[model samples]
Target: MKRFSALGAMLALAGAAPLAGAAPQPPSCARPEWPQEARRYELEGVTTLNFRMGPDGRAIEPTVARSSRWAMLDQAAIASLSTCVFPAETVQRVQGKLLPLQFVWKLQGPDRVPPALVEGSCAASERFDRYVPFDKGVSGDDGVLVRLLVRGDGTPYGVKAEAGGADPALAQAAVEYVQSCRFAYPKAGASPGSPVSGRVLLKQ
Candidate 1:
């Protein structure tokens, strides 16, 4: 299922001059795609952010005003909103206060199934505790998809990047990242001999 609903093109920007005496709302801009990892784990929340407009009408020093209680969602919101540009005059007018932006993440449809942990699945070991540095200059889609072969003892025996358009260095980095992770194994009494595949998002 397509979890994200696109209002328009992924990178399309809708430029509208801010009207005087109008209710405040997020500027019309490209919508952020839900983090794949977050969507896989059924994580959902509202992330609110604020940032000052740069001299070029771009977002500068964006900060999270209210967390969605999830780091991935917060980062995703920040990454997308950073691309928003405003008129220089409008920015000057609102110079005293940071522009407010909010992203609401909700799973589509009813009867949603809760995410379940699979035995010996490396995905079960995915962790968000390690923070990925946010570079405002980097594209949100910059990431590599990795495949893994897991051992019965909760360790990956084989890790490789799927052949595709991702940069070679980025792919290597992703392989190493997965190789360093200790995956989830089956219970002591359970049989654990099978090839399991998993992937990680390296959104920088």
Candidate 2:
């Protein structure tokens, strides 16, 4: 079985008020577990999350300050960091401040990590933009789910898409969008012409 884990969080002061006295101890944070979906795709990246400390020492209003390229990894970072707890003294030192925490997702072992979707590709492509207007204005938070086969060379093919409880027309648009995009896998680790199944969630 493949193993995936996140590195220890790197913390930085984001507009945190200067301490007049001694610096407080660092907060206890539970790093996020790598998403299985990302693991299956061999995705890796660093996601930065920002949050304030609540009176009870738990993270408050945790939000992704910067995406890890993949939504799955970003969501995983937010969900896990929300459970972080600052010491009472640390909370006061950083009260009402948005602290930045960086979580890095890295695959363990010798196998090379597979390619991930290029940043700002696929659903964010110009092709997707052209199709969106003609999608009959079908828009919702419930994005379309698309499954497709990607060649070892990173070419996407045979997209099978489905709408998430919306009009089926969205599926057709998602198919075209997915096929137009590219993946970034190395030929050394991937077999040429070998087809692999890939999934993506397309949202407006």
Write model 1 residue lDDT over 16-84, tens digit each, in one string. 233232224434455677787666444556777767667776778889877765567788888887767
- Prediction 2 TM-score vs. true: 0.54
TM-scores for the candidates: 0.45, 0.54
For candidate 2, write residues 49-143 as lDDT tens digits: 77777888888888888765566778888887776776788766667866676777766766534445555555565324422211222133444
Find the 10 residues in a row with the least total lDDT in model 2.
130-139
Candidate with the greatest lDDT versus the true structure: 2
RMSD of each: 11.4, 8.3
lDDT of each: 0.53, 0.59
Which candidate has the highest TM-score of all?
2
What residue runs in model 2 are displaced by over 4 Å at the alpha carbon? 1-3, 6-24, 110-174, 177-204
Provide the lDDT at 134 for model 2. Answer: 12
